[model samples]
Target chain A: MAKQFNQLAYTNLDDFVYGSCPNPVTTKSGMVIGGGMVYPEINFTLPGMDINDVTMPKAATIYSNIIEGVLKRAAELYAPGVLIEFETLPDFTEHPKYGIEVNRILLNGMKEASEKYGLKTAIRTTPNDLREFSRPPVMRSGKYWETMLELYEQCARDGSDFFSIESTGGKEIHDSALVKADIRLAIFALGILGCNDMEFLWKHLVDLSNANSCFAAGDSACGFANTAMVLAEKGFIPHVFAAVIRVAAVPRALVAFEQGAVGPSKDCAYEGPYLKAITGSPISMEGKTAAGAHLSPIGNIAAAVADTWSNESIQQVKLLSEMAPVVAMEQLIYDCRLMNAATLNGQQLMFRDLLVQSDSALDVQAYVLRPDVVMRISAELVKTQDNFLRTKLAAQLTVAELKKAIVEGKVKSDKRDMKWLDKMEKAIETIPDDPNEFYNEMKSVLDMDKFIPSEYGL
Target chain B: MATLNDVSQCVLDGDLDGIKVLVQALIDDGTDPIVIINDGLIAGMNIVAPLFKSGEMFVPEVMESADTMNEGMKLVKPLITDEDIPSKGKIIIGTVNGDLHDIGKNLLVMMMESRGYTVIDLGVDVKEEAFSAAVKEHKPNIVGMSSLLTTTMMKIESTIKQLVADGLRNQVKIIIGGAPVTQEFADDVGADGYSDDASTAVELCDRMMSDQSSSEALSA
Candidate 1:
């Protein structure tokens, strides 16, 4: 309820500590046994080779071993009066049922490690392989969210207090945006579990421009975190936006005033730089971009905002194509092993120093017609970007243009496109935009007439 | 007195309930079930397929339309005798082992079925042995495989190998599809062909079937 947020007077980033990441480590031996995306970094540092070179079955073994090492490390870090949290990359559990069993075995070990070692400890949730399917009239959550929540719920029942929502799927424009809604909705649903201590460690949402990189799960986690924080900051429902170009010699500066959270599947890796730069209050300022299993898109997003009201979790939406049980499942190992072995400091710092141009400094009129300006610029940029789905700026900017067309009587006022667009843009228009309402509006657009029921067959 | 055009309209409108009411009326009028299926329902699906390829219809809408066709088929099926049901073809489809995504695979099944083909959906995470066993059991005209992830996509090749190892590869034509699949990928995997989407998938199956029959006829 909007009433829930009116209760909060204010919340700020000063309430937290600056988290630190690790530098690239050296291999103790010539043989790189493990400690990369596919292995637990207990004895071995990252090797020069690709993590995917290790078979998945072998990687699964390494992942299980990593869980064992986290317990060992936690025991050493634990003290009676102190609480410690660490990142675990026990990615890609074999079969869902067997994976659950493995999780229980590890959780029992974790609880034992906590009690025996005399420390309060928690590990972030690991995502299972995702499979979205269509079953006519609904897009069912096949193995992806169903298995994730099952594992999450099992952890909760078994005394795992710290939980995060992790989900991954659909790398298209409408698809990823739909995935965002699914993640937000899942996070909203999982919030009821009373797991207030949430963290962002996910299978990345957007695709990277790097020819070498696979999907970066952490990038998704970070964007989710930013959206969560942004949701927390505004403290209200209605959200609005104006698409604008604030570009300079380096492209990073172009995004300053907007503070946008871009979600695209490929080549739009800008979300990573935009995400890594944000500093916010979380359970811990620290995070681990480990080489996780390239399966589920981790959905749960959490930040320790300066102030968090109970039961106030982000609520987004779900429902992709008209078919409920027939979602497409496509996978990429997305081994970010080389980068995962290294630190995020380079990514954060890389975007920090770029030359920036500004449009935020313009007059109030510029702000009022910002969406119009977005269209003009995106239209120009479209010529440069052959990969349209990879970038949401033009599509969203066009949505902004579509709205202007309706208002000026150039398009039908009662059109489904206009109605859904109006709802989303209006939600985006709200100063403290409602992530729930905004996400739902975008989702509704996918459920329109032309997309489904038409006088023509098929 | 309902013509086939009326049946096509029901499919286009994605009106599941309407399909039953109209099909029932035709049956009441003593219309032959085979004619209803061939000229009515199948004709409607043929039109829908093109619209779908043109992006005029999406997955959800197409699925809805497909659902309507299935609904109409229920009434027509029982009425049409085995003599009237000379099978166009039979297909066995499944997503490979460790690869559970099946939207594309399922879509192809629906498209093929509408064209008077029988389909056996083996479902997601199907193992190689399962494919061989199913091919033996069903003796399908085509064995369709799908994998959404690169990690599991290799299973497509392995499954192809298993089919050959089982010696069932000669019995059935193999077609594969998914997000990462391509014509080159299809060629490398030694597949009969690749389909970029569900529409072309049916076309791929039809062409393969025609070729198979043509070769058999030539040999005879």
Candidate 2:
């Protein structure tokens, strides 16, 4: 079982600043994520590698070239410390050996880069979650789960400095709710199903990481909130709804830290700020720099509270001057350099406030990410012991804040969009505080055919 | 007793239980089942389609409304035979090979179904052979593919190639969507249409079906 968070990680919001966490994780290569200054975590993808072409040799060559290009550029730019994340293609992990071999390749590149350039570096190996390989994917206890565990173990043993995954525990439910814009079901997915999966999965990963002496870096809500973020970006859903769902996702991601994963949460998890506020975990966040991977509304504001700023993920394709990953590294290094300079000059808080002020009022998505807002929402979040109630309180508080911001003319929003806020507030108000009661009510209401309760051990 | 307007309101409110009660009440009041469907259920969705496109109603509200309509339909659909009902068209859709992401595809499915199309959902990571097989089996008016990953989007071309290889290319119009998918990519891959969002995808399907019928009429 995971440890329950009964209180906020810190007392004073004003002093709850970025560039550090309660449990800072130092990697095998002496790369510290939350020790003091913010570092760049560069995530890169294979350049258009087809699923059929993901053999061991091809993965090795492709990853080597990509990392060499990124690190070589980092060396040229005189980057102090960098973190490279290898998020596996599903095929690489479907065959666990290939996944392990690829991890070894990535680690070797990081080692060589550190030795050759006299630079400090670490590698985060994130195995692709393949439980979704089954249609109406069995979320737990299947061949896919077994192989996923095997890959994690081997990768950790292979000297992966950090362990992370974009786990899809409740994605089957969350995806359905997201498309429907059903916040009630979305809460059920994130607060209940997702929390259960995180506890179960993270417990094992933490154990494995401990056994192998690696950092159990936190998981991402990539399957949940990121999906909503992208859908909102495409105008498939309202930004207000996506913004509220982002806050609702905090409890689920928080389960990772409760299960003993330390710091530097996954770069793709935008819920990192709330988790950082609640659990004091070092969080890797991506924003404007991640436009190479995906476009988002909270570009500048996302960098406000990050311990490790990342470029999300860039492909290894070539640009006019350099490879895309190399270009991404140069951009990220400069961003980190500026941020570190601010910290060195005793102006980190001023820089953080500037980042927060830049984008917070422009959009509701950006507004909720403001450090003050994160702390405010997270304070209410820790008031509840139930995950369902935590999710509801998160949504209710965010809606209330957005409404307040709109009324104050701080955050501009259309009048018609107010109906959604009202509707969500009304819906959240009707939810029971007890998780069991809420679960029962949801079971009676939601379309159970869309997901398997058995998979979540419901 | 509930009026047809009340039934429509139930859908608009996404009152699933209310819709069931209202639909049953209308049936008990001897309301014509077809009138209830066209005027009550679909009429509500018609309002939703525009509101959704206009961004007044979001995807969840729209889907809730659609699900309410489905719930209401369950009560009335049994009273009639297949020929008595109207379907917009048949659509075969799936996420392309090597891509398991289907929230977008599922939204398109729901939107298409709510608009009265018969949708055959092949689910995610669908291979080219499966797509061609679905087309051959269902003889759909349109084929839609979704790919959220840049890497897996390349599979859309291969899937289209398989359709052409199977000599099924001319039978149905092809459409593609997803974040990374674009109009140029669709044209490059020989897809007949592209839409960025689910509502637009529904509109694209309607336009393509209309165009196909018009072309067939001219040929005839």
Candidate 3:
């Protein structure tokens, strides 16, 4: 059975700061993830590099070198500790045999670099979700699902310290809901389908971690909320709508912890602050530093309460004087150093407050990410044990706050944006608190042809 | 006693159940199906598209309006002959192989369908052979491809190549869209058109269809 958080771990926002978790997991490399100063989680990708389908030798060499170069840069910068995340491109993990070999080589590089530089190092292996190998993706069982499990098992056996995945559980429906901005459907996708998939997927992931003595860090709503944020950034969707979806995704992401994921949730899950408040799990957050990966309104404010500050992911391409990943390492070390300095000076709270105030009122999306705002919505969220109710309550609280902020002129808004607020509020009100009724109504009203209920065990 | 205006209001409100009732009422009251479709359902959707572009309307609202119009379409469509159906063009669309991302593609589908283009959605991770087969079977006026991954986006070029090899490339106009897709890339790959957003994709299709019709008129 997984550990479940039924109440807020830290009632006072002041009690909740970066670099600490109530239950921090210590890695085998003797690096502490939480309960200390903030560390940089370096995530980098192949620079427009494609993995060949036939052989592993060339891909393995290229990837292993990237790892060595990043770790070497970290050592030269005198960075205290680092968690290097290898987020596999789909082609990497589509075939488990080649994927396992690639992972082994990358882990070898991390080990060598750590021994050479005396730097505290750990590795997070995030396998790409290949469940989309089939249309109307079968989440619970299939050859694709089996391949995902095989990659995780072998990666753990190969000495991966942390296991994470940006799992695509309810993405089929969630994608449609996002484009349509259907709050009711978004709730069903996130609360019903997404929560169910998390419990099922994480149960096995947590079990694998326990058997291999690895840490099952957590999942991210990177595909869901982050997609909404990007669309909002492009002016394709309203920022207010993205803000509401961000809060709505919290309870769904919290399901991962409910199923036993520990501290330091994935980067790009901008909903980290709310999950941090509720689960007290140290979360990895990327902000201004993550601009190379994606842009958003919550850049500075996203770092306000991050336990692990990260540059979401940079390509291994070169800048003028140095490689891009190396440049990112210098930037991240300086960022974590500043954050760690504040913690050491006993002025972390003052720094945290400054971070929040800088961007919270600038964009509606940023307003919801404020630590105080995360706390208020999270407080009401924990009142219910049901994931669906928690999702609804979170959305309700966030919508109320956003409306008040718009009226008070704290966050800029267009008069037309009010219709969205009203529509969202009305939609939330109409959803029956009963999950079963909501599910059935969604079945009737939604484009059910695009969804497979059996996959979610409905 | 329901008027066509009542059907339009239901679509504007995105009241799915109300749209069903109002559309059925008009059918029972002896209204012409095409008039109800054009003046009522599509008319409401026409207003929604601009509002969406102007930020006065949001995605979900526009989606609801699309769903509402679609529901009304289902009721009125059966009453008309295939030749009488108003269509801007037919489109075969999908996210190219190795890329499962389709939120953008699905939005484009909705927008295209709302604009009276008959879009046959092939869904995500669609292989090159599948696109060739779809073009052969559907004989669509235009083919659309989408890819959200830089890794999988190369599949678009390969898929277009397959279309050319299969002798179907010149038969249909080819367009592409997605996050990483650019007009420069599209041109490099020999695509006829590219769009960054769903609304603009619809407009591109409109322009492509018009140009195609104009060329045919000149040939005749």
Candidate 4:
């Protein structure tokens, strides 16, 4: 299980989760990659067709062509990963059968391009109304799940590396709690069937934080930050960080970097200034902030470079190479820190800006050792043996250590002293029995203390 | 003899087994199938729909109630011969060409069916000609179109334009909807109605049909 949790061993899983590569880039000159995470807009207009006589295949061809163009261009650019998110118009005729056909065509096209270029890809189906139990009828009817399982099984059989099922908006269905349960069920079912290839993907860490804002607000960004913290603490690697550096930084370095871009969008409302306040910086500048400032510049640089590739095709390749390592490291370090923090806190640790107060400028080599520094600091804090320090440190440790301590009574606290233990237990129950449960249990136990109570006093 | 109140009580209690027995009793007692449907099953749905909209009842409860209603409908539907099935209006619904998504479409069909609309679903990837052919054959009062893909959304307009060119545009009202179908898009396509969900589709279709029937009566 510990070996499986290692990122290096992730690709070996039968069903692996998919994530976008960091540092989307352009080639030196020629190509343009404009569409970011959103699905690229396509011209839906059919040429030379009388409305009454327009054929299904002809209409489908337009979409097929657009997808082909994008994938071909991505292959040429040599992108390590790309995400395809689904959204649709609410026409009654657009039933499951039609959706399947569309998905089939796109998947086929993606497969063809992936085979040709060895490009990694991720797919995100759109959010359906979980409150209504209304999914795209295909999905609601269970056929979609069956189809997905089959597709995954075949992919596993074919030695295709990564795939994932993601729900959007943290809505009822996409709720982390619900998704965790569903993933467990999927894994158990798949495992029982002897189809060991199954993986759950987590993307858009920033988005998840944003959606869980009310919970975060209640806990002073604790709930918002806790999901990532818990996942990391549990030794579960998040599939994608989705602007993690931006989530924790002062003034959110990503926003400033994006603001510097050609068409800069506003910083997400929930973050922006509030995050800046927490991080103790008025505005984050490039190379100034610890996290996003260092990484966002790379993404900006990659985007710029990718834009110049030969017709966006070669640009993707350049972007992937540049971004892959950064993304991998960002995810790895963030998860590791989260695990450490949660275990030490003896509760889910709230995400906070890791402010390293250095007396002087440090080289990249010095900064690379920050993880060890954090682990050391955490260990010292725990040994203080003060109740508060012990409590805090218990919440801060990695899941493995936290679980061991809890079981061994190394971190002693009475039932009353640890009110969060119950909540943590419930959260742990949500995960399936994947030997990963040990870590998840630790995460859940730690998170309870981070949750702000509804009232000032019990 | 089971009365509408009896059926309503059964629904309220979520007694699918009891509802089934009561419905059978209603049929044996010679109550008109349509009367039982309207007064018993539909009445119960009408009672629950508001609760669902108001958040008084969550999804699971509504689904269970709908399931019960569907069970009752199954029994009543067979008793009602083809001639007895009341048609609020005839509708030809399909996903636009190239877009093959149907969850939204299915929901709309279920809601519309519950409300007594006779719908001919052309399924996904329906071409313009097929839509026109269905319209011509069914002489539907309205055409409801759905699309899930932005890429395939434009097919709705093309289909409408084709209907107009074939001199069938004035004969029927077109309603368009889906995740991306905005009111402005519906207007641009010369569609009479646009709605976001299956529940809304039912309401919109009812209003459209009522207006058409009233205008026809006024002309007469």
- Give the docking tier of candidate 4: incorrect
Q: What DockQ does every candidate get?
A: 0.07, 0.49, 0.41, 0.02
Better of 2 and 4 by TM-score: 2
Q: Candidate 2, which segments miss by more than 4 Å at Cα?
A: A1-4, A53-59, A383-386, B1-47, B64-80
- Alpha-carbon shift of residue A108 in model 3 (angstroms): 2.3
Q: How would you encode candidate 1's per-residue C-alpha lDDT over A1-458 as one tens digit per residue?
A: 00011111112212111122111111111111111111111111111111232443454454345444444553443311111111222223323444454456555555665556653433323334243222221112344445544554554454433332222222212222222222222222222110111111121111111121211212222222223222212211111211111111001211211122111101111122122222111112111111121111111111111011011111111226311101100001111222222324343122211101122122111222222232243334333311212122332344565566556654323333344456554433341233334335445544342122111011
Docking verdict class for candidate 2: medium
Task: Mark the 10 consecutive residues where model 4 chain A has the least summed lDDT.
Answer: A305-314
Give stretches of model 1 more than 4 Å off.
A1-165, A168-458
Cα lDDT of model 2 by residue, B143-186, tens digit:
99999877788899999999999999999999999877889989
Distance (Å) between predicted and true CA of A224, model 2? 1.3
lDDT (tens digit, per residue) of candidate 4 on A96-120: 3344444556566667767787755
lDDT of 2 at A74: 90
Worst 10 residues of 2 chain A by lDDT: A47-56
List ranges where model 4 is wrong by over 4 Å.
Answer: A1-458, B9-14, B58-61
> Largest DockQ belongs to which candidate?
2
Give the lDDT of residue A66 in candidate 4.
49
**TM-score of chain A, cand. 3:** 0.97
